[model samples]
Target: MQFRNELDFAQDLDQNDPLRVYREQFHFPKVGGKQVIYFTGNSLGLQPKISKDYVDEIMKDWRELAVEGHFYAEKPWWDYHERLAAPLAKVVGAKTSEVSVMNTLTVNLHLLMVSFYRPDNKRFKILCEEKAFPSDQYMLKSQLRHHGLDPEHALIEVRKREGEHFWRTQDVIDKILEAGDELALVLIGGVNYYNGQVFDMEAITKAGKSVGAAVGWDLAHAVGNISLSLHDWGADFAAWCSYKYMNSGPGNASGIFVHEDHLGKKDIQRFEGWWGTEKASRFMMKPEFEPISNADAWQISNPPVLALAPYLASLKLFEEVGMPALIEKRKKIVAYLEFILGEVAETVSGSFEVITPEERGCQLSVLLHGQGRPLFDYLMKNGVIVDWREPNVIRLAPAPFYCSYEDMYQFGQILKEGILKLSTVDSLG
Candidate 1:
């Protein structure tokens, strides 16, 4: 697509967008009586306008039904979590039973590791991307420490070559093989948070499987942003938070995807709870755990109905629009965003470059070589909402569900102006 630099082109695209109405479903943050141009959906998505209604429904059930709400409410609390299975399954591309809403991301990661990350004298190392989300970094380190292994000795990070912003698939495959006898597990971000690069998860899983290593992904950035088929790709297990592209809410419940092949295996250990017990036996008061033969087997507690309500509200939208349609819209928006950024780069004398590759989702991590906080602050003050990573990168993710092509064009204009203003300020200083 030859993207035009004119505002009319963006406006036309917005008018033609099939999903343009989706923007109205969300509550955009207002600054000075106008909605800010939001591009941080990769960090925290905007609140769905229907979120309050969903939460209120749960609250009403609690008020009137009390304990009876567990079984008697309109959407019974007893089965509140089960309702999420089909929608979450569609989002992650798995059999309904293979997916479940559970604890937050890191907690689920640790739970999954209990079964997948079994280190031995021959296989004791974990391979993950360099500079993974800090929570993942700390989680892996702590997991290794819990097993009496040194982080330096047991963790293998696949790094881009010097000067590169992202890792190549072959490089990761090479590292997986290089670790060979010492590799017990391979975990990577499905879409890296810093560079916005979507890894070749299918190929990465295959390579890890070839080396007798279990493969998993932290899909915090990938879920609901790009197409996924964790079950088909043969990912051993995966976890993701719903607050970002999923747009559930801040710090909402995360999801788990455990491939069916991994389920029904008695050897796989998980921290146990009543929530995972088979429904028929759950209320029997029997002692021995009869686990559900699916991802719910990993649940440590009954579903948090309140926390799950907001995500359930958003998942209804996911079920309606589906990932295929969302992904199609994403491709167009990303192309327009790339084109706008390219145009901005050409007009600016300041050092500006986009580090995200074409194999990315909504995010474009711009490298502000000589200009950083000053430029970012200017954009924010001017009603542009994006995020800044330390050292010199700014991440702008125009989410397809709510972000319009006009938003990209306007953000580009803001970038163009911000750079020029900062360059002048620096010259005067």
Candidate 2:
């Protein structure tokens, strides 16, 4: 915990880390031959070396069994999707029956909205955070139009107070109360994608439910990075993509959560598909639709096993390390990064600010005064992989599973050099 300087601190932390061995399992990108400092896990996770083997197994089964792979193959393709439920449930902190792997993130969001966001004449407004992921915003708007409602009138975007970087817990509660009788559903990201704020899900859910509105979340940024208890938190539903921290390759299948309380409700509406029919009668090809009794009822088609294999591989890693331990490691790594940044900020000419520390996950948004794109491009060209948001902010995520304390320190050093070099040019001019 004590260090002479940043590099010393990083080396010391790396030497003592219990999860240090995990870094070897992932396929970190190389520049010439050396591994790049990969801080972009918030965007796309590093692939597991085992991910190829997992996919190859499925491919082999497909090639050998052809159409018969579903029932006869090892691990049986027909029930392959069900295999993911228990492990994924543990990852999201839900009961096994409450979770299921399914379509992409946006698709699952729309499907959940169909059943949960039942807007009526009086309670027709849907509440969400401002600046949610663009796909989420588009889905909400399209869903509103599908129901013959004007999005401008029906969508309520809860924004941060003036000049603020993130919303306080009370700010969200206040908006839900203000919406009151008009609020039909509250849907927000589990973590703000741009700023990395981890919203208070339990508080948000309680507030929405108090107003008799359904509550849901888009967990794309939060699921693998934080410990979530959607069942105990009383969240009505949630959805997440696996390609980021989950390490499930791009455009991989997403997962969904539905509280057990909503499962038996006969009146709840969903877009029916044959795969969602009662498992006992699914193969009967019956004309009548008897939906499955759990969250799987939301499924529209049989799962894509190839897309799921990588997730299965990653989830195994989660089970081995466990969420609680992973979160503890994340806190240490994040705090270390924060400390280094604070030190560098004091020595630098321009102001540097962290936008979402109070309510955030592994990622941090840093604002560089008067310089944004130039610094961002400089960092990327130097083999430090951070992402630039438009205008001013740069997002760096030191993920727990594969990112190291050494990685954070090195990236911090690179950032300081970038800032110092830019300052020198400014002074010369």
Candidate 3:
């Protein structure tokens, strides 16, 4: 809670960390044989050491059993997808039947939209946050066009107050009310990718419900970073990629959640496939589309077991640590990062400002007064792997699973040096 400088705080915090042992489980990247201070878990999580073994198991099954792996393999390829449900459910705070691992994030987003975003002529608008992840924005617009509606008129974006960098909960609620009659669905990021703002999901869901709209979230950033209860929160549906904080390898399989209440609604439309067909009769290759009565009904094809092994490994770590413990540990690390940044800001005469602390997750978005890319490149070259968004923002996320207090401390030092170097260069110009 208190630190004189970044290193001092890091040393103290690391000494007390309960989950510190888990760091050795990951394959931290090295530069010149030295481990880089990797704060870019928001982009790609460090791979778990167990991932190799998990992948090997699947490979072994494929080699030995050949095509018969579907029924004869150890875990049984036919039921391989079901293996992820219990652990995946634990991560998203949903019942086992309420969650399923399937498709890429964007693909699952379109599938969910098919069932939840049934826009009629009267209530045809889709509500979302401004500057949402570009993929989501593109998907919403395309969905509108697919439904024979004009996106410019049919989509509404909730934006920040003038000159601000984040949206307040009340602002979102007010916008939903303003679009009351026309709003059919509200889709928002669980955490804004650029600014790291974690929206108030429960309140947003309530507001959407009040307006007679279906509410969903894209939890790409928030899934492993924060605690979630999609089922209890009454979220109609949600989807996320596992590569970031979930530490599933790059372009890994993604997941989806559908509330149990929506399971048997035959009126709701879905783009169905044979994998979603009734499991018992699926082998019969029946013509009738009898869907499995749960979130698994949304699956369009067989699971990719190779892609899913890493997720299974990473999620087992989550189960061992538990969400509440992990979140509490994260709060300490994040608060430490924030405290050090404040110290640096004071020395720089307000040259840098943290844009979204109140709404932020572990990530902090720093806005440089006049310098941007040079400072980011300086940090990157110095072995600190923070990410730079376009124009002026650099996002630093201290993910609880793999990030260390020492790493945060080292990053603060690297950042301060980068800023000071930039200031010197600017003065010469």
TM-score of 1: 0.98
| 1-429: candidate 3 lDDT, tens digit per residue | 346674666777888899999989999877667888888889899999999998899899888888998898878877788988888888889999999999999999999999999888799999999989999999999999999999899999998889888888999999999999799999999999999999999999999999899999999999888889999999999999999999999999989999999985556689999898889999999987888988889998998988988898888898899888888988888887888888877777667788865766778888877567888888878888889888888888888888888887777777777788889989998
| Top candidate, metric lDDT | 1
lDDT of 1: 0.91
Evaluate residue 334 in candidate 2 and report its C-alpha lDDT on the 0 to 100 scale.
Answer: 85
Poorest 10 consecutive residues of model 3 by lDDT? 1-10
* TM-score (C-alpha, index-matched) for candidate 2: 0.97
Which of candidates 1 and 3 reaches a greater lDDT? 1
Q: Give the local distance difference test score of model 3.
A: 0.88
Tens digits of per-residue lDDT for model 1 on 1-429?
Answer: 788988899899999999999899999998778899999999999999898999999899899989999999999997799999999998888999899998899999999999899988889999999999999999999999999999998999998999988889999999998998789999999999999999999999999999899999999999999989999999999999999999999999999999999886666778899888888898897888888888898997989999999999999898889888899999988888888888888887457888998789888898988788888888889999989999889998989899999898888888888888888989999
* Residue 23 CA displacement from its true place in model 1, Å: 0.8
Model 1 deviation from native, Cα RMSD in Å: 1.0
CA deviation > 4 Å runs, candidate 1: none
Summed over model 3, clashes come to 0
Better of 1 and 2 by TM-score: 1
Candidate 2 Cα errors over 4 Å, as ranges? 264-266
Pairs of colliding residues, candidate 3: none
